[model samples]
Target: MRPKITFFDTKPYDKEIYKPLAEKMGFDVRFVFYHLTEDNILLAQDADVVVIFVNDILNEKVINKLHSYGVKLIALRCAGFNNVDIKAAKDKIKVVRVPAYSPSAIAEHTVALMLSLNRKIHRAYFRTRDANFSLNGLMGYNLNGKTAGVIGTGKIGKSLIKILKGFEMDVLAYDPFPDNKLAESLGYQYTDLDTLFQKSDVISLNCPLTRETKWLIDKDAIDMMKEGVMIINTGRGKLIKTTDLIEGLKAGKVSAAGLDVYEEENEFFFEDLSDQVLEDDVLARLLTFNNVIVTSHQAFFTKEAFMNIANTTLNNIKDFCEGKELKNEVKI
Candidate 1:
């Protein structure tokens, strides 16, 4: 019998993409539309591997439950395994993820958010549609010769730096483990967080959410940034404290914000809650700001990225089942 793989928090697009890929790979996987909560852990029973996404709840309890159910491997379709309890799964189950599906896809989306927010494209589009073509408030500054500070010099960060260089923007990047050689080759400078915040005209968060990185952008960080600085986050949502960001926006410390993820997005994103009242006041308040643009965590939603995700996830499962080396395995 083919190995059974259970997928949690699957969307329509996930099914549309994974079904054909899995079929071609001669594998069978079950798709669960809802998130993997403790209540639905039974759904993973009898499966050799469990596939999950960012929103799934895989705490110690869930990891213990999966171990009881004989699930040997946990395959994450995307990068950032902060949702999983690696320590709890250690010695009981293995974890792997697609660390770099399409860095360019995410990088391009980051640029799109920056351009739309800075150039006021979102506001301009609505005004033109309403026959109100006033350029009174659509004024935007030139990106050329401005400084861009990028956090987390990973593949996506590197890609973003290359694009910023094309715009003639001087780039300052901060990473816990700095690759000075790569920075030199990319024509960017590696700086401390304080200097990056104090000097940059635009700041972008492209790092993973870890204990050290959680709430990396808060009141203190904002206070150090340049006045009227543009902030962009295409990374994990919790990187910025949303309430603090709101305060910065209100005080005009942050001129604009472009977010593809939110600190509390799991309940709101990937769903059609149009007819219902949004009880999350923080998210609702964010939508009210013309200077703020929040996307539905779609930075990695390109066709190439999706195909690569599917192929990598399936390959991870194949590798686990065949007892091969797990190149993408996440170690505790």
Candidate 2:
């Protein structure tokens, strides 16, 4: 019998992409549209492997339940694994992930968000459609000479720096382990977080969410930033405290915010809730601010990215099934 793989939180795109790949690779695949929660963990009982996306919940309780059902591997089709309980699955089931599907996809989206917010392109499009061509409230500053503070020098951050360099923008980056050589070669400098906050005209968060990085931007961090600074987050939502960001917007401390992620986004993201009333008060409040552009966490949504994710994820599962070395295994 072929090894069965069950994919949770499956979307139409996932079925379109993964179905063909799994058939060619000779694996039995199941697509579950809803997220993987403890309540629905039984759906994975017959699966030899379980595939999950960013929003799937795999807590200790759920991991234990999967182990009881004989699931051997947990394959994450995306890069981030913060939602999974790595410690709980360490002994029971091996876990692997597609680490770098398409860093450029996210980096490009980051710049897109910045440009849209800065030039008020979103507003301009709507106004023109309504036959109102006045440029009132549409003035925007040039980005050529502005300083951009980029947090975390990972692949995505480095890609963003390259794009910013193309725009002739001065770049300031902050990372716990700074690469002086990379910085010098990229025409950027690594600095401390406080300095980055105070000096930057634009602050972009591209760091991973860890114990140290959770709530990295809060009241105090916002207080240190330059007045009217633009903030962009393509990283984890928890990187910035949403309530503090709302307050910053209210006080005009932050001129604009371009967010592809939100702290409490799991409840609403990747789902169509237009027909239903939004009950998330913090998220609802954010939508009211004209200066804020809240996307549905689509920074990594591109054709190239989706292809890379599907191929890499399938290879991860194949390696585990064939008893080959799990090169992408997430070890505690």
Candidate 3:
């Protein structure tokens, strides 16, 4: 019999792609839009496997509950698995992830956010729609001569560096295990976090979310940044401090912000909350800024990325059920 898999936090698009993919892979997929919580842990009671997303809470309690019900594996569709308590799942509930579904899909969207924020394209389009063609406060700086700081030089970061280089921007990257061969070929300079922050005209975050990376861009880090800097985050949200970013934006220390993720995104993103009054104060304030561009964490929402995610998720489940060694198991 095919293993029963409970999929949590599924959107319509996710359902559209994964339903067919799961069928093709012969998975007994049970869809649940509810986030994984103590109350909903029973939802996976009958399933042999559980598939989760970023917003789902899979803590010790949840894992133990699932284990009690004889769940064997936890498969993650996204690259980052910070949401899952890997230590708790270790030895008991096996964990795996789709490490690289489509790096370029996210990389291209990172550049898209950077462009839209820097050039005020979203604002310009809205103004033009209303027939207001004035150039007041719409000036944008050229990217050609600017320096771009890349936090992580992984697949997505490497892809982003190539795009920035195409615009002739000097690239500075920081990674504990820097890919010297890739940097040598791509002409990217490796630098410390302080130097990258102080000199970069544009900074893009492409790193994973871990204990070391949480709140990487805090108040003091922002203080070290050059004034009028543009910051973009296409990676994990908690990497940036929401309040600190807001403070920087207000002080003109940060010229613009293009975020595809948010620190308090659990309550707001992946759903339409336009009609309701937003209870999240920081997100509400971000909407008021013309220089800030928030895109509902859609950096990985492209067709190519979705397809790759679907395939990888199905394969992860397949590999686990087949008693094969899980490929992308997290150390912690």
Candidate 4:
């Protein structure tokens, strides 16, 4: 019998991409529109593998239930695993993820957000739609000579640095594991967080959400930044504290913000909520700011990235079924 795989939190795009691939890969795949939560944990009762996205709640209880139901593998389609309880699933069930699908997809989206925020594209587009062609309040700074500070020197960060360099911006990066050679080759500097925060005209968060990096951009960090600095986040949302960011925007310490993720976005994103009133006070308040741009976590939604995710994920399950070493397995 083919290995049984149950995919949760599936959208139309996910089904469009994965269903055809599953047939080619010879796996018995099932797609569920609902997310994998504590209440829906038993949905994967008869499956050998459980596939999930970022929004799925895979805490200790959920993982324990999956284990009890004979689910051997927990596969994540996205790179971030902060939502999963890796420690709890350590011995009971193996976890794997597509560490990277397309670094350029996210890297390009990061630059897109920066350019949109800097050039006031969103505001200008809306103004033009209203038949107003005036350029008032649309002033934008040149990125050619300005400094860009990038957090995290991973694949996506490196890709972003290349693009920033192409725009002739002086780049400063901060990471615990620094690559001096890459920085030198790319004509960028790797500096301490304080120095990067103080000097950068535009700051971009491209790091993972870890214990040390959670709320990395709180009040104190904002205070260290340059006045009227542009902030862009394409990484994990909790990397910044929403309340602190609001305070910064109100005080004019941060001139603009572009967010592709939110700390409390699991309940809101990936769904059509246009008809419903937004009950999230912080999110509603954020929309009131003209200088802020909040996207529904679509930085990695490119076709190339989705294809890579589908291919890698199915192959990961295939390798497990064939008793091969799980190269993408998450180690606790």
Candidate 5:
């Protein structure tokens, strides 16, 4: 019998890319549209492997249920796995992830947000559509000479640095263990966090979410940032404190914010909430600000990234089932 796999939180595109790959890998794949929760653990009963997304909860309760059903592996299609209980699955099941799909997809989207916010592109397009020939508040600054700060010199951060270099911007980076070779080669310099905060005209957060990174941008950090500084977050939502961010926006400490992720986004993101009132008050308030641009966590939605994510996830399952050593296996 072929090994069975169940994919949760699937959109049309996920089915489009993963179904074909699953067939090629000889797994009887089942795609479920809803997120997997404690109550929905039974959905994995007939499958040997369960694949989930960031929005799905892979807590101990769900892990135990999957174990009872004989599921041996859990595959995460995305990079971040804070939603997954690693300790719970360490002994019972092998956990893996598609660590890097396409860093360019996210890095490019970060710049897209900055350009739109800085140039008022959305507003300009709206006015052009209405035949208004005025450019009142559509002024934008030149990125060529400004200092840009990038936190975390990972694959995505490194890719963003290349783009910043092309723009002739002065780039500074902050990482605990700095990539000195990449910095030297790319003409970027590594600096301390305080200096990055004080001197940078634009601050971009691309770091992973860990105990040390949670709320890294708080009231005190905001105070240290240059006034009217533009901030961008394409990585994790928990890195920025929502309340403190609001204070920064209010006081012009944060001149503008371009967010592809939000701290309280789990409830609203990846789902259509247009008809209902937003349950999260802070998120609703952020939406009201003209200087803020919020995307539905779509930084990794490009065709290249989507295909790589689907193929990598399905391949991980196939390799596991075939008794082959997995390349992207996560060791808890």
Candidate 6:
């Protein structure tokens, strides 16, 4: 019998992509519209593998429930694994993820957010739609001589650095495990967080969400930054404290912000909330700012990234079924 796989938190696009991929891989697949939750854990009772996305909550209870149901593997389609409790699933189930489906997809989106925020493209487009061709308050600074501070020098960060360098911007990066060789070749410097914040004209968050990195851009950090600095985030949401960011924006310490993710985004993103009033006060307040640009988490929504996620997830399932070493498995 082919291995049985149940995919949760599935959207129409997910089914459109994964169904054919599963057929090619010769696996029995089930797609669940509802996300994996305590109440829906039973849905995967007969499956050999469970596939999930970032929004699924796989805590200790969920892991234990899956173990009881004979589910052997947990495959994540996205890179960030903060949503999963690796320690709880350590001995009970194997967890694997697509660590790098398309770094360029996210990197390019990061740059797009920066450019749009800097040039006031969103405001310009709206004004033109209203038959107002005036260029008032649309002035943007040149990136040619500005310094860009990048947090995290991983694949995505490195890719963004290359783009920033192309614009002749001086780049400063910070990573616990800095790749000095790469820095030397790319013409960027690795510096401490304080120095980066104090000197950079624009700061981009591209790091993972860890205990140390949670709320990395807090009030104190914001106070250290240059006045009228531009802030961009394409990484995990909690990497920045939403309340602190709002304070910075209100005080004019941060001139503008381009955010692709929100700390509480799991509640609003990937769904249509237009018909409903936003109950989240913080998010509603963010929309009121003309200098802020917020996009639903879509940095990795490109066709290339989606295809790579589908292929890698199927391959991960295949490897497990064949008793091969799970190279992408997360170690607790």
- The segments of candidate 6 whose C-alpha lies over 4 angstroms from its true place after superposition are none
lDDT of 6 at 310: 93
Better of 1 and 5 by TM-score: 1
lDDT of each: 0.94, 0.94, 0.89, 0.95, 0.91, 0.94
Candidate 4: stretches off by over 4 Å:
none
Candidate 2: count of backbone clashes, pairs at least 3 residues apart or interchain: 0
Give lDDT: candidate 1, residue 17: 90
Q: RMSD for each model, in Å, please?
A: 0.9, 0.8, 1.1, 0.7, 1.2, 0.8
Candidate 4 local lDDT, 1-332, one digit each (tens)? 49899999999989999999998888898999999998877789999999999999899999989999999999999999999999999999999999999999999999999999899999999999999999999999999999999999899999999999999999999999999999989999999999999999999999999999999999999999999998999999899999999999999999999999999999999999999999999999999999999999999999899999999999889888888999999997
Query: Which candidate, 3 or 6, has the higher TM-score?
Result: 6
Q: Model 1: how far is 49 from its true place, Å?
A: 1.1
Q: Candidate 1: worst 10 consecutive residues by lDDT?
A: 20-29
Clashing pairs in 3: none
Clashes within 3 Å, all models in order: 0, 0, 0, 0, 0, 0
Write model 5 residue lDDT over 106-212, tens digit each, in one string: 99999999889999987788899999969998898999999999998899999999999999999999999899998999999999999999999999999988889
Which segments of candidate 1 are over 4 A away from where they belong?
Answer: none
Give the runs in model 5 whose Cα sits over 4 Å from its true position: none
Model 3 accuracy (lDDT, Cα): 0.89
Worst 10 residues of 5 by lDDT: 18-27
